[model samples]
Target: MHRARLARWVAGSVLLAAIGWLVSIAEAQEGAAAKAPAAGAKGEAAGRRARAGQLPPYYREVVSEEQRQKIYAIQAEYNSQIAELEAKVAQLRKERDAKIEAVLTPEQKKQIEDLRAAAKTKRQPRRQAKGNAPAAAPAPSKPAPATPKP
Candidate 1:
């Protein structure tokens, strides 16, 4: 009777251990599946990833063809409106510049030109002149020499 009881206890323990092992394996799989989607989650999570430059501009990973066409159409409409507005703005700026130029003296115009040259140093990077190599960064300015005090 004692041997029988001992065998039953061992069997129960093994059953419990097997169940625990199965539960752990199931939890591990669930964690892995959850991790992947969480890392590449859609909507704002995807947008933030793109903004951080971690992913490409288009983050609609599994978009259907119908949805893609609709997105393209919407983008086209916005782009057209943007181009129209930009052209109007450019025309208005040209008119404004002409009006301002009409008011300024030659000396003031020279000063404005100097200011514009200075502003250009703040710089949008220019494309490379020829080869595949990236354009060099602007040279560092030399520090002004200090005048010796008498």
Candidate 2:
């Protein structure tokens, strides 16, 4: 059981990592598109070179203008293909999640949901405390017992 649970966690982590990578790529492409200039050959060429500047430090430094254009062209060529594959991956992931959810008994499903809610409640206070939460009121002090003959 522990092994199975661990395997699930590992798989989930890998999936999350892949999703994050794809999202970053998509954002990069979107940013490049937004920054690309309107019309002229000079503007387009500049845009391509600018996009190439987004490359890692080593590659960005070594690549020539010609290479930048080529790299930019290659990225443009694959962008749509990558987007299609990402969409397919998302559909497959949704189906996989539905199938996994279906395997759970209703009671198990409810139990997991309750566990999630409990976990969320546990996190909420910590988050609030981390933020600008108001200081909690001090508990009222008890009055000293009536003084005996001292």
lDDT of each residue in 67-117, candidate 1, tens digit only:
655565445434434555557557755775686598789999999999887
Whole-model alpha-carbon lDDT for candidate 2? 0.71
Q: What CA RMSD would you report for each candidate?
A: 28.2, 11.5
Best model per lDDT? 2
> Whole-model lDDT, candidate 1?
0.59
TM-score of each: 0.41, 0.47
Off by over 4 Å in 2: 1-53, 119-150
The residue-by-residue lDDT of candidate 2 on 13-73, one tens digit each, is 6886787688778877886877754579557665655664355558888999788667776
Model 1 weakest lDDT span, ten residues long: 48-57
TM-score of 2: 0.47
Q: CA shift at 19, candidate 1, in angstroms? A: 72
- The TM-score leader among the candidates is 2
What is the lDDT of every predicted structure here? 0.59, 0.71
